[model samples]
Target: MSASSTPAPQAEGQRRTRRRTLALCALPVVLLLVVALFAPLPYSLAQPGETANVLGRRDGKPVIAVEGAQAQGRDKGRLMSVTIAATQPEATVRLPDVVRSWFREDRAVMPREAVYPGGGDTKDAEKRISEEMKDSQHKAVTAALRQLHRSPKDIHVKLRLGDVGGPSAGLFFALGIVDKLDGDGAGGGLTGGRTVAGTGTIDADGKVGAVGGVPLKTQAARRDGATFFLLPKSQCGEASAELPSGLRLVPVGSLQGALDALKGIRTHGKVPSC
Candidate 1:
């Protein structure tokens, strides 16, 4: 038989193999694109269910003005806010500082095991919560704020969800609550509007948590004209390592603590206009 007439099994097999290889390579690429476009990964491991309440209220009503509904479906905009005319330091201290410290240091300190390395799937748990509960607390808080601002009900306490990686945001969150209560405008009439930048996580009891990526965040905040940068007391030393010479690292531990820290910054640690 002529060469052309013979069946080419080897050639056909090679072609099939090439097609399979291409498909396999394409799968991961497609998945990565989806993660990037639709749902990004969480910055920290403090998943959704671990802690439920994030807002605080005063006088039987929400003290902060939140726009939770607006934040819905917005991945990065997820945040919690509290409405209070004034921050009460005693409320936070009422809880054991040791308990607070445990949470503060848990992520970085937890040891990994064989079954669930890196603290028994703790990272995985946090990742799941961050993904499934995208901006949930932010929406809840915003809705509550709107309701209280309009109706003035007897709720008296509020909390909302917030992001993780960006601990510096705690400063902004704390200042927002303070401005809402003390500022001339409704909810303090403070218009941060990307003017001032901050980092650190705020506890319901009003303590700030240490955050990673201090240098990058601080540089970004400074570039945006943030006069003050809020940092967790634990992370303060770490943050100093990355702080730009001109940037201010306002060390804080809790929401109430942040307010206290801010007073010190406003009085003593004022940064020169950039």
Candidate 2:
């Protein structure tokens, strides 16, 4: 072959090799972008939500006020409810967002099935949460009245938890009711001028049941300046592992146990710890 023709062929071959190498390198990047934009992840992200004061008012109404009983005492400390911010099943979560959430300390990456069971829609999830909240309120009122040895007919307990939905606030709801009805009396009110945050599902029998998102709840509590956190005995380990510094975790199996712990806090008595 002639030298000029040979040089042209060699140059063309080098160009083809470079093009192939470039295409191979670009393939992974293109695939990653496509997956990050189009592919939906089966997981959801949960973050810490704000803490609400159960003893305070929401939208101009007392959250836990009684009509018959005299609700006295200044705002000594807060009775807060911890909440978790989560994604709905119907929402699209890309891979990049999931990866980012996984690395964020304040965010928790969990299976979508774990957050929304049965693959239900947002409306279905809201309905379930509303029902759970109503059930929790009823159980909380009953438990508080029973603990106070008061008849439901004698006392009218009105809970004004506006727009907040979940059974996790049950424990705090009961405590708020008791605090309002008891009016800072000895053995009646237990807040003791200290901020208290808690989460659990309560029953009319005063049994405390475990709830999800304890770690996120704890973070919320800590951010809200809570000194103590009350939770179910079953969730102690998980909560303890993620509990922030300067916050104490107290485990209770029953409403009475919770009251006792609060009483101990007030009187500087020995309190149960997780």
Candidate 3:
């Protein structure tokens, strides 16, 4: 072959080497695309969700209706419960979704195992949530009655919650009950005409316990126009770090402490801070 017509050996080798290098570089891109599209991530996305007023009506019925005692009028303030959305076990989460969640301030990325332990199914998660809700409601009612020094037999308390399940509403539920019972008494209502939002697990003894999703809950409370938020004392640090502007965070270790704080709000007294 003529030297001009034939490709040089070194040039051919160089062309092949360039092609190999391009292929090697493209391999990772192709693999990443595939994984991003199809592979399930080990983490789940959590985001801030809706807030509901415990004292408000739902489905044409009062959320917290009292029978036997004089039903108090609605307070000017609101007691809200915040919720967070978490990925279910059966749902598949991709890397792109996780990456998106990481950039969103209201969204949280958590390990799948941490969200759904023991590979539990969706039904199991629902059942667990329902149990927590029921327990919280019971505790809240009991605590409120105890704090008011009222007998459960003399008053009937019915909680009407629609499709909401979580223990984080316990504190607000207790507050709502107390406000309903007190109704502008000497100490004034628990809310005292200011939007109050809170999240915590309450026991029968009125002790407040920490719950998860404090940061998201704080954001939700602030978005809902809550002037004050009550959180378990143990979660004060998390709440303080993410405290929204124009919202006051009060850390309470017990139900009485929450009441005292609210009274302070109403009376313009010095209130406890987180």
Candidate 4:
């Protein structure tokens, strides 16, 4: 009986020692978790941002004009351009925020290099966005003129959207110009009398290019009352991740595809899906 009682205490002590050792082993892991939660990460957060209808007014003026071209839309429908609020090139996003962004429907996390080109400072990033904006405007106009089969010299295109810098608005800008000049080439408006929103980089040849931060842009589109969204074909998968309800996704490969999608939505015709 004495020997059995002595071993019972020894077993209890052994069990206590095992628990202490396990806790000691777990301490470093807990510390790492805390560090990870607060450590600065090389990523950027994309959040829902403002939307502007290219066919509508801003500051009591037209956002797009073909120079003496009779403005269309506003009452018929709205062609909205979606923008996303994101961390600048020089932002230090923490790991916790990045993880949180992934779970939030209105937010997204992107690699710093994916959104902003590397090997440049914040100023360089701004300059690049500015140049891209100007280039997108030119390409949008050129694509519009090409679609209309008109000479560039015959048309003077002027686009005003405040200090917004980004190339994602190109597709909407082209649509606005086309709507102002001609109505879907079928006596119908480009917007099909419905609020449409989209994002993509435009080429002079009418090819649409993928723009990042599409998931957050989709949230902005839905928030802005868009019934249809035109996004580049390449980023359809990304856009589908957090797409808000009541917004149909239209995958466009070019300027003409987007116009057809809007027209299809109006006429219930066959439209391409993402």
Clashing residue pairs for model 4: none
- Estimated TM-score per prediction? 0.40, 0.84, 0.84, 0.85
- Judged by lDDT relative to the true structure, which candidate is superior, 3 or 4? 4
**How high a TM-score does candidate 2 get?**
0.84
Clashes of 4: 0
Candidate that scores best on lDDT: 2
Give lDDT: candidate 2, residue 19. Answer: 100
Model 2 weakest 10-residue run by lDDT: 181-190
| lDDT for each candidate structure | 0.41, 0.85, 0.84, 0.85
Q: What lDDT tens digits, residue by residue, belong to model 2 across residues 111-209?
A: 888776667889998888889899999999999889889899988988877777888889888888878877457534467788989999899989999
Model 4 segments more than 4 A misplaced: 1-34, 68-75, 119-121, 186-188
Clashes (backbone N, CA, C under 3 Å), per candidate, total 35, 0, 0, 0
- The TM-score between candidate 4 and the true structure equals 0.85
Q: How well does candidate 3 score on lDDT at residue 258?
A: 88
**Candidate 3: stretches off by over 4 Å:** 1-38, 72-74, 116-118
lDDT of 2: 0.85
Clashes, model 3: 0
